[model samples]
Target: MRNLKYYFAIFSIFIMISCGENAEKKVEEKSKEETQIETEAKVSEKNVILFFGNSLTAGMGLEASEAFPVLIQNRLDSLNYNYEVVNAGLSGETTASGKNRINWVLNQDVDVFVLELGANDGLRGIPIAETRKNLQDIISTVKEKNPNTKIVLAGMQIPPNMGEEYTTDFRNIFPELAEENNVELIPFLLEGVAGDPELNQQDGIHPTAEGYEIVADNVWSVLEDVVEKE
Candidate 1:
């Protein structure tokens, strides 16, 4: 009887230990699942920025990842802000082209827009009236779809050879559209770098990497009002 009692106590202890081991494993598995959920949430906490422009915004001479939109993303990262910038630039696209595709562009879940069209139109000496009308339509469409969306219009310049009067009309288009639409205005997309030969690529049109830096800087000062990086 004494031997039987001793063996029963030993078995009870072994059963208790096994149950404890099982409970510990369950706790560990739940902890791992919680950790994974937190990681995914952290990765998704960022605003979306969309850049709609021509070859300049496309970073024609640069790699895909080195575009101005990507540069802005890098800047935001350095500032410890969470945001995603998408480049939707198409080479040789004019204001008319942008107008046609504006609806499709707004389909994304973008919180902000960098409007940089009309450069090709000005370069091609297209009618300023047509350019202005097309841009106005795009602005209206965007405002209709996402009323809270912030727009930053990138202004362009026409060659002086086109005569001062025509150039004046071309330059007026951007500011007029921006003011009418109640949006931010980037005085010149390539300010501090446009006319400089060293800043430009071989085409004397597109900016080099350094030039894009200046472009991003010009846009950065006013970008805060448009996008709140968190």
Candidate 2:
């Protein structure tokens, strides 16, 4: 009886050891899988190009993927330019609102920043001085966050409903700001798309997908230069 009991104890100990070994092996396999997934995710990460603006940037009323920024991404990808474009565009957003939200949007590292705000302010007939100041502040904040970051300012214009003076002043804001800040400027975001019924949505303000393609081209003309230098 005593001999039988000894054999049983040894068998139980062997079973426990085998179970522990299997558990340890499983744990090691899980750790390796997690590490591999993390590495893959890191490998896929690319430097960010942030597009900050209004509805035009947001691609409102269309699939988010159809937006100009994403189109820019597609362009960059096709060119083999390594960049991750982030569109932080909000519909109906004004310069003041952009100033308020700029910091939050810049929380991550931005290789390039495309400023597209102030159009809504122009549409609302906001004071040009106030619009300019808000845009200035937003730029200042961006520079403060990343001095080496490249900036591209998008110019916008409104109809002459507010008279030639207001419309002209609104049109001049972008170039003036770009010159003053030494940032690259996109002359007119809408350019070929604006005033074209075929390219515009029913509102006659926002662009359709085709219009966004032109807008993307306008932005790319300047952005490409900046990217090459970087």
Candidate 3:
């Protein structure tokens, strides 16, 4: 009877030890799961900067890495800014197409929206009023989707092939919209790079890799202020 009692006591201790270990293991698992959830939330919390535009934004005739938007991303990362850049640039996107597609792109939360459309419209000699309306509509949609979204318009100018009157009106559209909508404006997206053969690709429109560096600078000038404010 004494031997049986001693064995029973030992069995109880063993069961207790096993249960304690199991409880500790479950606690450790829960801690790990909580840590994973927090890490995922941090990643998802990163702000998004969407570049919406045409081939210039798309880096036409150049590698995607060579595009100005990616260069901007590199700069942001180097500066330790926690922003993700979404290059929504389609090669042939005009203001009308951009207006049509703005809703789809707005499905994701956008912290900063850099508008780069209307260049194609300018080049195509699309009616200035029509381009202006399309651009305004796009801006309106963005504002409606999220009033908190900071907008930045990339001003562009085309050759006089479209006629000086039309070209001037097209150029005026950007600032007018910027003032009216109270959004940031990149005075000239290709400032130093435009009209320079050395900076242009063989097609004489898109920027070369080296040219894109300057273009990135132009964007960064305005974008830096907006980002810092944010």
Name model 2 segments beyond 4 Å from true.
Answer: 1-42
What is the per-residue lDDT of model 1 for residues 133-192, given as tens digits with 9 covering 90 to 100? 988888888889998888888888867867798899999999888888889999888889
Among these predicted structures, which one has the highest TM-score? Answer: 3
Q: In lDDT terms, which candidate is top?
A: 3
Residues 127-225 of candidate 2: C-alpha lDDT, one tens digit per residue: 999999999999999999999999999998888988999999999999999999999999999999999999999989889989989988999998999
- lDDT per model vs. reference: 0.82, 0.87, 0.89
- The order of the candidates by lDDT, greatest first, is 3, 2, 1
The positional error of residue 208 in candidate 1, measured at the CA in angstroms, is 0.8
Model 2: lDDT equals 0.87
Off by over 4 Å in 1: 1-28
Tens digits of lDDT, candidate 3, 56-123: 99999999999999999999989988899999999999999999889999998899999999888988
Q: How does residue 220 of candidate 2 score in lDDT?
A: 91
Residue 22's lDDT within candidate 2 is 55
